[model samples]
Target chain A: MQKQWLWAALAWAFAQSAAATPTGDVNAQLAEMQARITQLQAAYEARIAALEEKLAAATAPAAASAAAVPAATLPAPSRGGGAGAFNPEVSLILQGAYQHKKKVAERQLSGFWTPGDAHADSHAHGGDRRGFNLDHTELVLAANIDSTFRGQATLALLDDQVELEEAWFQTLGLGQGLGLKAGRFFSGIGYLNEQHPHQWDFYDQPLMYKALFGAHSYTQDGVQLKWVAPTDVFVELGVEAGRGQNFPATEQDHNGAGSRALFARIGDDWGVAHSWRVGVSHLRTTARDRERHMESELIGEHAVAAFSGKSRIWLADFVYKWAPNGNPKDRNFKFQAEYFRRQEDGRLAAADEQGLALGESGYATRQSGYYLQGVYQFTPHWRAGLRYDRLQSGRQDLGSNPAALQTVDYRPRRATAMVDYSFSEYSRLRLQLARDRSMQGLTDHQVTLQYIMSLGSHGAHKF
Target chain B: MRRFWLVCLMLVLSAPVLAGVKVLATVPEWGALAREIGGARVDVFIATHALQDPHRIEARPALIARARAARLLIATGADLEVGWLPILLRESGNPHIQPGQPGYLEAARYVVLRDVPQQVDRAMGDVHPDGDPHFHLDPRNIPPVARALAARLMQVDPDGSATYQANLDAFLLRWQAALRRWEAEGARLAGLPVLQVHRAFGYLFHWLGMQSRGELEPKPGIEPTSGHLARIVERQRAAPARLIVRAAYQSDAAARWVAERAGIPLVVLPYTVGGSPDAGDLFGLFDATLARLQGALR
Candidate 1:
């Protein structure tokens, strides 16, 4: 028996070595030995188990009862359904930047109504903390909640506060090309508005977005219904109803929704290598007391202007992407442009730092802005981009409060050029230079170096 | 006008019966396989062509639209389409083809995978936890995948069960005979050492009894750096490889650099169907690959 066992052991070792090394013809030999080893090992294990059971019975009759008592009281084994088994996909995005800018008196959009937060560009980490800055660090978690729904949440960690940027659940398999989403999410009014800052081609938002949507672009706590047409050409339509509680609109008291939006998109492949999309969207909301920041000789040092009434915005966006043979790894070019026009008819109230009312007026204005940008990935790792932003103040009719709700003659415009390098798909570094004339009479030349890194789950980007 | 209306009505009436199961395949190889099994009973739409890297694909609206209409979705799986497939499935809004459903078929699940990692780490350069997803290169792996696909097709389109079974049997016969021919032709390539640009052809090397010297890249998915190439060249000088091989989709620059420095011929294999002019289908893909390897070795 000992000799046979030794032979079996030797065979097992040989088979293991054979398995470890890649030997083409020896596969058959290894398999035969593996079979013999399995038989010997199973037979020996069965014998050992039988012997152990007999020994246990002989040693102590009370041992079985004791084991049974604990077994009965123990919690039932998990059916592979628990928090430990279900791991949600988690991703953390870290962004930081260094800025060098030419000094300007006050950072404000010249031709449009600037929000109180306008001086602090959304890209700036903490209120334009000039030199080195830590941008928004985002923690994102996403998972299929069940068979019917999938949920995602994004938490933005700022220097001083942690904000829930997006928390929403979307229907997964809603048939007939229909999907429903509810909770707080970015409003899909424009292409760039839906994309987060880290996904932007440039380091900063366009002058149009900055002047119109304030520091944080439009986000709504609402419900959205979208339908994609079952056709060869891509066609999508969506509508949203939300509580108008952010910038463009202030918090409202009524239970009814304060904001509504309608959007439609259509796109198609031009060829094997090119694709394009065009979309139009409209958002309408009521502003209770939307505050704007202004500093003019008329209102003195610190002036607060509040506008309350109807706010309506219309946006048209177009995107064209080209990749040779539809493979973007080597090289690709993307051209994107959006035109935004806003009309606000409201009552404007101006108050100084001392809470003294300067003036009140019926404000009516037609303002429009557009941005054109092109990003080219010259190689697998390097990309260069150029963008131009222009905003026009069509007509501002401040009935009784002309001095309070002011509109400048200058047009807000900015030109930016940037080059970014991706070390891998998860990490990127960018250097950007821009000439900004958004501030009435001031032209600021800005240089920014930024880095973005992603950890954990890989997020899919929507085109 | 009356005749035109009558013809339109007749065409519309016949559409459902004539139209087969709509199948969306994520890659050209799977697309070709779906065609072989599904035949005319299925209309296969390939989401990506052979020229594109299967690992990276944009979830384009065009793909989503196609997915929306597809009754069945086929993927290589084993995380090959992990980057974009989930997003496409979510956006497609097609309930029938969602995961764990009858209409969803992951080909890798049916085949025995190679190079399954003991531990997964991204630092290993995009290593798949399940295994290398390039198993289609080994022709022996095709039968099981084909069988699973036939089963899936039958399940999704019960009316075409007879056709799917017959097509699968016919495909297996052709595939078995072709495998024998490939094995005979590949006999001369046994024990030949080759440098691979990536692990894309790991199964092919194992199938043909060829030996791998090393990879051009420092790690999988990572591009070859000058230092890495120099190291590969230095190692090749010590233990020489016969040839340098790269997939047609991969750029030849790095492989060429290593080949020139190490004094070996560089061969670009058609990694999948339609990857090269000669490799128009599954059979052609293997035939072209074997021909190129044999030519380079000779």
Candidate 2:
């Protein structure tokens, strides 16, 4: 039995050794396969590198040839530093108009003395001149002052007279959604108040704007603070304190606050194609030595008055826009309207050529006006617009001066229709026709053909 | 007093959890890429929708609000957003995202731009002097832009560097693999003649080695005059193209007008993420684009 056990153990050992030898052979085969894969990978990488080199070589020549081609007429990209680097983006807008009206007469609104009533000064009123006119030329210069401030200045040339339109410096990086703007700026009271004349959709200002703000919108030297809330819906609040030297208020010495305004706006998108915004604004100012000349029926002569007191104006505005699928390239529509009510309480002192005040009496006046317009872009380059304006003068008491209180029809309205073709965003040709009944009894048919062209870099307008 | 202190402590503790770098992108495609590269480290906001044209945008107050809070701003920036971006930057009052700042990243600076005009006159209908700003159509251009964006991201948020680098490395691997697959599949598309609506697809055509037969628009923004259309139709009769291509945001009337007359199919490619139902994200965007092109093969 001992001899048999020894033989079996030897056989088992032989079997185990034989199995281990095959395992070693399998390991050798696996190593060979792994080495083959590594070699193939190296070869593949080498081929890729060669192809990449070839691609680089091919593209280098093409890029060189392209760069060698001169692009003298092309405006260089606006970068931080280069020759003329500190020079601001300068843009000049030229506006010319040819006007043909049925009657060329003194323009007057009879009922309530409008802020921009017929003034003898040519600069005080717009649209009064007839025939070919170089309406206005606007020159704008804007640049970053440093990393912390941006400055913009605009000069408007009207009838060969240069007027400082706007000059402002705005702060940058004042966190917490706060922004500060100082210097002369257009007051943000209504939708169109801040827009320059070159950006207006029509050739003439709305009748209501003409009545309240004079042909030019209210601009003042002021400091403004604005805040935007962090929310899903857009909400903004702004306040301004200014030196009142514009239409509603006469020029005054810098003493206390002359004008102050507060405004709030909220906006949101309805869908992919529609957006709307609504805002309410309130403005208050003290008018000191406000002057106006009227043909007094009592004396049948030109009489002058200087009034001093307070004026408060409230404005509400809404805007709606629709573009198919949020793309305005083909078709879009914009509708906007603003309503304003003014309350004036003051005393008027009439002077008869002499420096002596004939009489001083207290008077109160209430007036309101609104304008609604819609512009439709039927195609990429063509647009048509229509606007309706109406004004209502409420009760006006001339302080017991029966002859001075001339009661003519107090309602004035106007309708305007325009069609414009934009060659590009910077150039447009507009033809406008209007029936103006702004004067009491006269109906004027007015036609204007205007062209606006812009040169150089101009910043984009806001929504 | 103890209760008030406890509440304040809780608030302070939770502030860091909610605090992340805010990034604002002008278009949805850039927003998607930002989300990918800035994973878990950023809050991304897109200024314009996929269906909106990049050439023009309203400076809406909501966009201004977003710009005010953003720590980083990424734009295509060969003047692609010139119509509104400058005003938005001025209004935002955020100096960090202004030009020449570390927080501003213009993707066009990293890629080789195409179709730079020799002369820039308005007579050419609003041509970009810096060349075509649509360079992201080529997948190969994404890497350099991605690297630059990664560097900017690090500069903006150094605490998240490792996370951003790891994410970028992974993304590069996947993007490279996908690029290879696309190249293999697109090999048959080389030298194909095609018609385009605008110069928007110059990079794509250059990548696929396709030849541009003609354009639907006479110039970039100008409509095709009848005379131009007649000439194009006459030319197509002699040398026909395989198909007509347009981006989702472009007007289809002109493309359809020419395609019908020339007897070629019209294909509207999803130019960016969210442009089509099938293009849900970056991967899906390229997949849908390739599939559409392949399906249009003659």
Candidate 3:
């Protein structure tokens, strides 16, 4: 009986409120009076709350100054000399994947020159093994060092080893559209090179990236200076000088800048829907006895060869994005393509297993490759992408060196497609398939199921 | 060639005469308010339009350029632009507009906010720890924010202090009169139950004494699922709301479906200035909003 009365009263109140008027009925009038009283009470309460908040707001600055007195008495932060505080914005990215592929004896790119041990470390290739695997777990910490500078460090943990992927400091208050960044960092040469692997739309690195810069692209201990033009169109020019210890440039003993890069980018928006950016860059470095291994048909054995001299690469990249009314929350499309041409001019020497030099040659070669990809977000959560990568052994001159150092006439290429679904901004799951023809006389059908998740600290999206 | 050089020289000579305090606003509402307060003493640039979701804005290079050149930056704050503004500030390399600087002003700091979360977690879906940043819908919240903006403008451009003060006083006088007129006209709208698309209109309902039946979204920042829509439909049958309401920027499919199933009128409010054809300025925004809500009554 009590429940029935409660239901009847609820129904009557709903009816009265829906009517939104003071009615002639006595019961309706009483309900309306009760509502008016409640509204008055709420108004008074809100006024009191507002008064209290005003009092608090008035005293907040004094309280803040008092708190600052205590904070000044505390010890200073340890890292980044003369920094402000120890607090830093931190984030962790966890990535894992499952892979299935037809087993191939060697996964080397056949037509192009490759380092012997490039793929020996499975973790370096983003867990390319046949079963379940855990990829790199990236931990990032960033903070403003002081009034003039800000610092960030990203550590990649794989297995039991921790690698410092990037640790750099950038100027915060440099006027005239000028900025400086220094320390170990990725060279901003191409659209994808500066972006971390976790931000990739696909599971694995592109064939062009892998064949050109190994698994990781153009990471170096360097200093960079960039200037952005003050014009309406976005224009940026940058130069980097670094101690190149990674792929394409072997580490030198005494380096007063072993490698250098110059890049220029121009971008603008077309109306409210389209945006585009185009860039060109050049990287020149020296390789000191970079090792390579190849099968020698003449000797019927694997011969070790070394290239020592200058290596130069030219790159051009373009990216275009389209969304309705500059809003990408629902549906959008992105197209990006990068092309690279590399030339090596130096001496190539073939050696035996006992370190005996068999033959030497004055080697000069030019190679080129390009990759283009398009990604479309059909719905709020789902996205699909297609990519095609092709590489050409443009020209090779082995000279009198052994046949093992000779370049084949074949071109390497691959086609890949992927679909990913993001549960939120923090987590995404993807399924990708590719037909790989990167190696000679091999067509390996590859499949990957991957998941990437981010914890703590929201990252701002950059374009 | 001589004429071109003469024109260039003239342009260079006149550049300083055209200079004013450059104000960069993260959204159209703040941009409109800055204009009303600064009048002829300031130049304003709005980063996002009313038809765009402020929370989902991307940090484009054009915004960075604008931010770099601005003397003052006005934002809603309380994490409303967390996804994009931080990047703009960092990449702009302009110290004047960084957080806590004299040129930076966050409007939420001056206004009373609603729906501050007790415990923040991702399970709740994109919760702002400080409070709701959509306090502009409540006419009462404007005076405080306008006063703060005028003070900030004075600090950024001290030469225009008197002009800013006079403009702010005139705006406040006009705003208060409009507020009184709105309250008198909106008296009949009291006690109306509304089903909302998101928590975008919390302060609007609070000011007007309207009851929210529920949100279409299961959680904040999450898309409405069919399961939650069905549940809302079931509840509507038991305690029916008078109308369904949504913002002009939000997708209307969910609200339309609910309105169809529940047999209620759906009213789309101009969430900010320039959100609709009728809402061309700050005054027009609220006028159009109130007019639409009252239209749903019939």
Candidate 4:
């Protein structure tokens, strides 16, 4: 009996190994397969070991004859299914580039000067004709837990610095079309900021983004209470609290450090083929007394805004990607774009008031600009894009104040050309050359090239 | 709300006689196979629509509503419907179709996948790179998948056990016969090196004995760069690729660019249902693809 039992156990283990391991590099999928294989292999070994031991033990006459029993065939059970299976998705994105310009980064501004947040000729000062960091890497992890909840965490190593991109949880089974999301995540306040910024078809962000959001780039650690309104139309609403941006020191009556903004966006069911969004944000921060510092317009923005009373920011933007002559997925088409803007009145206090320069800083900087871009997909995987940026700078008297940095005068115009090719879902490469002669003292000419590689199950997001 | 009532009404109107077995299918291809096996004794409906991108499909009131009334549910979940199928499974709340239940069948479980990536990541643009999700494109996968489906369906409707087994047996014989013919036909077309715009039919090529020299696009989601295409073209010129392949809905820019530059013929293959008018059915899809490839290569 003991020997008969031994053979049956050995068969079971062999069947187990056969079941583990499958094709695919999904972390969750491969790990499960590996675990199953180990378990089965162990079980099979023990069973066979026990069988051999039993056969040896049954060598004595009566048991030995009966031990010559039939071998049992066990069912193969190495499978991945049922509940509680976690998917570990691994991704690697490498952006490599060859550039023809010198390194250009916003030199860390002097503390409390808060002036140089302008798209003016003086914004870069002697920094023009400079080469810049061309390579950036972004990695993300996201998974849905059952049907009601999902979480995502992303880590970015870009421009030689690493930061958490997104760490948030979403509740899907809430009120109709309502999703409760919380955690420190990217504020979807701007157009290009929301999508893969580094993956922008162009070599750099539009001129408008550089002016309004500051050269430091945009990100705030705060909580956002948002909802997706129920309807055939796609609507989103959000309220946030964080370090406020864009306020001149002269405009605030209290601390401008803690900023707050409420914004909403509505898009048609048709998706990016055509969409529009508008938002109004207000912020305030405590003023820092930089009495004796050589303060630029960069630092004194909030102090100036606070002193000026009632700080606010109003923004509206729209994008319409049409392929009217042919299919949206194919064919050459024109990419339309436009945006309107205005700054708070009297927020632009000059340097004597410890604010921005005439029109660059604490001055109430009035601004307006729009652009037209067209992308023609000459081939399925090949596309060429051209865009023109026409912009206006707020005059020191009318738009400049303490928050504005320099004397606003020349409003530079920009034109760019981009050519790209997509090889597959995981890899792509592009080249861009453009001239930024729109700003004063900033007649910039440069060329940037980029390549992105995605390996593993991470490629699914491309589809 | 009234739309919900109308959907329910339609289900009631199509209510089958309890005498026949019932089967629920996830895709149209699976639905067709189930009918062929179950013959007059089964009823089936494909839950997913052909027009939708399989990966990004959203499960709405209608699909969830249909799954609840069905006795069996079949899906191609290798994270294929990462966006929605799981929602339907839970919301349908059909105890009968829950995972590990007698009625739930994940058809892709039976076969091996090709080009399984060693890693998976979101930055790769919605990758399932570990393994290809287009398993159904390869007809050889159908036999095992159909067998698994038949077994699950039979287990659910025990009274129709004989009918299910007989049907499955017949399918196996017919498939074996057909496979032999296909084998002979495909052999003459083996050893062909081609470039595919997308890896949509990686599974099909694996079983069909064709070699894909490279894909037109450099990466999965990222478009090709001029430098990359120039290199691909250079590679083609040296060894000379025989064919350039593409899907109907998908563009052929990369293929055309390389084909024109390298002087190779590009074959636009039907990737999915309705990829082309001639590829109306699953069998026809492969046949059309093979014929086009062979003709181009010849």
Q: How good is model 1 by TM-score? A: 0.86
Q: What is the TM-score of each candidate against the true structure?
A: 0.86, 0.87, 0.87, 0.55
Better of 2 and 4 by TM-score: 2
- Model 3, position B119, has a per-residue lDDT of 85
* Model 2: per-residue Cα lDDT over A1-463, one tens digit each: 3325544765575556556677567666556656765665456545543443343333412221111111111111343346776789999999888888866566755565656344533444245778887876889999889877889999888755888889999887676667899999998888888888888888887877766777457787989898877665778899999998776887888777789999999987887788888999988988887877755665566667667888899999999988998788789999999999989898877765455555667768888889999999999899999999899877766686533624454788889999999888888999999998888778888999999999988788888
Candidate with the greatest DockQ versus the true structure = 2
DockQ of each: 0.21, 0.26, 0.18, 0.10
Q: How many backbone collisions does model 3 have?
A: 0
- Best-to-worst lDDT order: 1, 3, 2, 4
Candidate 1 residue-wise lDDT, B46-163, digit = tens: 9988888888778887888898899988898888999899988887888988877878878766565789888777788888877889999988888766766776787777888778
Question: Cα RMSD to native, each candidate?
Answer: 12.4, 10.9, 13.8, 14.2
Candidate 3: tens digits of C-alpha lDDT, residues A234-334? 78889999998777888899748888999998887888888888999999988888998866665668777788998899999998988888888878899
Q: Which candidate order results from sorting by DockQ in descending order?
A: 2, 1, 3, 4
lDDT tens per residue, model 1, A365-401: 8989999999999988899999999999788887866
Error of 1 at B53 (Å): 0.9
Give me the runs in candidate 2 sitting further than 4 Å from their true place: A1-81, A115-121, A124-126, A295-298, A354-356, A402-409, B1-16
In model 1, which runs have C-alpha deviations exceeding 4 angstroms? A1-85, A104-106, A117-127, A293-303, A351-360, A402-405, B1-10
Candidate 2, clashing residue pairs?
A: none
Q: For residue A50, what is the lDDT in candidate 2?
A: 47
Native-to-model Cα distance after best TM-score fit, residue A157 in candidate 4, in Å: 4.4
Candidate 3 residue-wise lDDT at A398: 83
What is the C-alpha local distance difference test score of each model? 0.82, 0.79, 0.81, 0.56
